[model samples]
Target chain A: MKKLWISLTYLVFIVLLIIPLIRIFSGSWAEGWEGFVEALTRPQSLHALWMTTIIVVSVTLLNTIFGVMLALYLVRATWLGKRLKQLLNSLVDLPFAVSPVIGGLMIVLILGPNTIMGVFFEDIGFKVVYALPGMILATLFVTFPLMVREVMPVLQEIGTQQEEAASTLGAYSWYTFWKVTWPSIRWGVIYGVVLTVARSMGEFGAVLVVSGNIMNKTQTATTLVYQDVENFNVLAANSVALVLAAVSVGLLLLMEWAKKRKGH
Target chain B: MHIEVSNLNKHFGDFHAVRDVSFTIEKGRLIGLLGPSGGGKTSILRMLAGLESPTSGDIVFHGKKVNELPPQERGIGFVFQNYALFKHMTVYDNIAFGLKVKKQSKDQIRERVMSLVELTGLKGFEHRYPHQLSGGQRQRVAFARALAPEPQLLLLDEPFAAIDAKIRHELRTWLKDMIERLGITSIFVTHDQDEAIEVADEIMIINKGRLEQKGSPWDIYKNPQTQFVASFIGESTIVEDVSKLKGFEDASVWPGTKALIRPEYIEVGKRSEFRIASATEPGRVKHIHFRGSEWMVEVTVGDTTLITYRSLEKEVLQPGDEVSVLVHRAYLFNDNDSWIMENKLKEDPMPIHI
Candidate 1:
C-alpha cells in the first residue's frame, strides 16, 4: 500500500509539473536555437524584460525598507496602544486576502486618469495610470506583505534583550540597531527580499490593469507573454515564459538558501 | 557611585510591579535584590538602569536627579539574566562594541579589550562567537563587555541563573572578588537566598512589590525586621502554636501568634547526649536525608515538625527513633510585628537531683 501511494504521488507530480515544463522548453526551441535567440532579442521583448526588471528592483527595495520599519514598529513600539497595534497587525494581511485582480481594480478606480488625485498628479508633471509609476505601485501593493510577514516573526523571536544590553553599554539607539538588531534579522530580511523580487517579477494581473500593456512604454514581460499568446505566436510566448520560469527557479533556489541561513 | 531611589513605583496598566519602593546604596558596595519570582526585584533593577521608567520616582545619583536620563547616558552597565551576548559577533567584537560606539581610537580600544579579555580569562576564545562558548564562558564574556566602558554603576539581573549548579557556585565567588577589586558599585538580583547571602555586601529582601528588609547578610539573618524576611532567608518551618513548646510557653504575648524555627536553632540528640536533659522534649525522627558531609533530620515534637542538621560523625539517626529536641530560639510574629523569643529554661537551669 505504501509503494502504491508513493507511485501515485510521483505520477501526479510528473503530470502536473514535469510535463508542462518540458513542453515549454521544447516549444521555445521549435524554430531551433537561432530562432529562440532572435525571439528573445527582439526590441519589444527586450523592452518588456527591462520594464519587469525595473519594477522588480524598485518594489523589492521599497518593500524591504518600509516592511522592516513596519515590522519593528508593530513588534517593538511601546507608544502604540494595544488595540491600535492589533488593528494594524491584521491590516498587514489585507494584500494576501484580496485577490490580485481586485487589488489592481481597486487601485485603478481610486487613481485613474479621470480621478481627482490622478489629475492632480498629472498637473504636477507625474502620471498614475498606464505609466511606470502605476505599474510599480500595483506590484508594490501585491508584494508588500511578503517582506513584513517574514520579518515580523524573526523580530518577535529575538526579543529586546540584546538591544537593551546595547543601550546600557552606552550605545545610542541607531548604533544599537546597526550592531545588535540588524545582524540578528539580516537573514530574515534577505528571505523577504527574495520573495518580493519573485512576486514582482511575475505580477501579471495587477500590472495589466494598471499599465494597459502599451508597446515599448509600459509593457512588462508577463503582459507581453499574454499578448503573444493572444496573437497565436506560440514560439515567442514560450520564449518569454521560459525566461520567467528560469528566473523563478533561480529565486526558489535563493529562497531555500536564505531559509537555511535563517535557521542557524 | 552612591545611588538613592525615593518612592519609586512602576505600574503596568493594572498590575503594580513596584509599589512605592525606596532604597539607597553606598559607593563601592555590592547590593543584592533578593525575592521570589515576580516580586519586583527585577523591576527595581531595570528602573535604576533606566531600562524601565518608573511611574513616579526620584533616582538621585550622587544628589543629581536622573529620572529623565536615557540608559545610554546613564553611564551604567547592565548584564541581563540570559547573558544576551551578541550571537553574530566574536568575543573580541562583543567586548569592543561599547568602545567603538564611543568612537575611541583603535589603539585604545585594542588595549582596553585585551586587558578585559585577560581579566575575564578568555585569552584563546577571542574569535569565537557566543554560540560557540559554554554557558559559563558566555557569562564571562558578558561581564567583560559590560565592564569595557568603565561605567560608574553595574547592574546584573540574575547573573548566574543560566549556568550549571557547579559553575554557578564558582562564578559567585569569582564575581564577588572581581567586584571588590574593581571597587565599582554593583547591584545584582537573584531569587536564590544562598547566592544573595554569599555575594552581596548587603542584601535587600523584596516581597509582593515591597521592600521587606535590607541589611548585611549577618544582620538580616540574625535580626529579621519582618515576618517575610524571617521565613524567606533561611530553611524555616512555621509553627502555629509555639506556646505549646516548653521553652516558648510564653509566646502568647503576640496575638494571632506564629513562629519561624530555623534548622540551626534546633538541637537533636539522644536523651543521654543532651546538655540539659530536663529542658529537652522527646521527639520522633520522621525522616533522615543525607546531605553531603551532614544529615538533615526532621523530628516531630508535640504535633510540630522541625528540621535540624546533624553531623555525620555522630551516632546515626534512623526514622522512628525517639530523640531529645531543644529549640534555642524562635522568631514569633503577629500581623504587624515580629520578635525573637529565647528559651526561658536556658536562663535558669534546674538543679541536679541525686
Candidate 2:
C-alpha cells in the first residue's frame, strides 16, 4: 500500500508539471517558432527584457545587502534593541501575508498621483507610481524576504564562533566580515539572490498597477504575458509564459547547483 | 612561556561561571586544568587564548598584558575537544590554516605542514578529511594544526576523552611523548583523574567554579588538599565518628571526627595487632571475581561496605566466609570535612598506587 501510494503520487506529479510543460512546448512550436522569434525580436519584448534585467539586478543587490545587515543586526544586537529587532523580523514577512492585488492597491493608495505622498515623491523629482521607479519598488517589496530568509538560517547554524575566532585571530571587523563571515554564507547568499531574481522577474499585479504598462519602459515578462492574454493573443501569451517558465527553470537549476556546491 | 592570570572573572548573565580564578604557570610545564563539566576550565582556557573575554582581570604572557589582545595575536595554540578540523580541507590544509592566515609563503607553509604531518604520524593521511580519519588520528590532526602556528603555549581540552578506550590509551602515550619532544608549555583540561595524571606535570582540580587544589600530580594524589579532590582523584572510603585515632591531626576535632582512607591501603588478613570487630561478623562473600592479577573481594563490615584486593594465589574467600580487614594507610580530615593536611611518607606504602 505504501509503495502504491508513492507510485500514485509520482504519477500525479508527472501529470501536473511535465504534462503541462509538454503542452506548452508543443504549442510553442506549433506556430513554427515564429511567435517566439517575433516575441523575442519585437521592440516591446526587448524593452520588457531590459526592464526585467534592470529591476531584478537592482532589487536583488539592494535586498541582499540590506537583508544580510538585518540578519547580522538581529543576531548580534543585545538589550532593548533585540526586541525591536524581533518585531522587525516578523514584519519583514508582511509581503507574504498580503494578497498580490491588495499589495497593488496598497502601493497605488500610498504612491499614486492623487495621494499626498505621491505628490511629495513627484515634487522630489522621482516618478514612483507610473514608471520604472514604481516597478522597481513593487519588485523590491514582494521579493525582499528571500535574501534575509536564506542567509539568516545559515548564520544561525554557524553561530558567532567563527566570527569571534577570526576577530581574536587578529582579523579586524571588516576583514573578518569579508573573509570568514562572507565565505560561510556565500552559497546561501547566491541561492537567495537567484530566488530574488526569479521572484522579481515574475512580479506582476503590484507592478502592473504602478508601471502603467508603458510599452517600451516598464512592461515586465509577467505583465506582458498578462496583457497579451487579455488581448486574446494566445500564441504571444504562451510564448511569453514559456520564456518565464524557462527562466524559472534556469534559476531553479542554479539553486540546485548551489545546493550541490554547498554539500561539497 | 610564563603566564600570569590575575583575578580573572567571567559571568554569563546571572551565573558566576568563573570567579576570581588566578594562577601562574612557570615556563614549559604541562598543566592540567582538571575539572568536571561546567566547572569553567574551558572558559579559563578560552580567556587565556583570547577566545572569550574575562569580565574582570588580566592575563599577562611573557611580561606583556594580553587581556585585550585578540586570539590570533595571542601566540597560543588551541586543540578543541571534538578536534575542530576544517571539514572542507584535507589534513594537509587543516594543519596549514594558521600559516595561511598569517600569509606565509607557499613553500614555507608546505614544509611546515608536512613536517607537522610527519611528526603527528599523519604523513600518509595528509589528504584525508577529518571525518575520514579515526578519532585518535583526528585528535592528532588537531594537535598538529595547533602546533603549526609555532605557538609558545598550547592548550588541549579533553583531547583524548573522545577516542575509544584502546585508541585513547595509545594516543595518550604518543601525544605525551610528542609534546615533550616539542617542549612547548601546554595546559590540558580533562575530568578524568587518570588522564590528568597521565599527561599533566601539574594538576589543578576545580569544583563548583573554584579551584579545589593545585599541586604536582603525585602530591595531589598522595595528599589531596580537599575532600572533594581526594574523592575525585581516587576511589576511597569515608568513615565518620570513628572516635578520633590518637596521633592523627583531625583539624576541627573537638571530641570525634572522620577519616578518608583509600582502599589500596587497607589490608584484609589476620593481623594480631588491632581487633577486627565489625569485619569478622560473617556475611556471605556474595560476589568474587578474579581481576586479571588479583581477586576483588567484597566483604561486608557490619552495615557498611569495604573493598579489599587479595592475591590470586590465596585460597578463594567465598561467600558465607569470615575475613579480617586492617586499616593502615589513612588520610585524616577535619570535622568541617574540608581538607586540613595529609600524612607524610614514613615509609613508601606498599602497592600504594592510586
Instruction: Name the candidate that leads on lDDT.
Output: 1
Q: Residue-wise lDDT of candidate 2 within A1-264, one digit each (tens)?
A: 999999999999999999888877776666787767886767887778788888988998899899888877777655446568889889889888876666777888998999999999999998888888777888888987888888888888777755654443445678677766787788889988888988888888788887888777778877887877888877777777788789899999998999887654
Native-referenced DockQ of model 1: 0.85
Clashing pairs in 1: none
Candidate 1 positional error at B157, Å: 0.8
Query: What are the per-model DockQ values?
Result: 0.85, 0.39
Tell me the tens digit of each residue's lDDT in model 1 across A1-264.
Answer: 999999999999999999999999999999999878988999999999999999999999999999999999999999999999999999999999988888888888988988999899989999988899999999999998998899999999999999999999888878888889998899999999999999999999989998989999999999999999999999999999999999999999999999999998
Per-model TM-score (chain A alone): 0.98, 0.92
Error of 1 at A131 (Å): 1.3
What TM-score would you give candidate 2 relative to the actual structure? 0.86
Consecutive 10-residue window with the lowest summed lDDT within model 1 chain B: B345-354
Cα-based TM-score, every candidate: 0.97, 0.86
Candidate 1 docking: what grade?
high
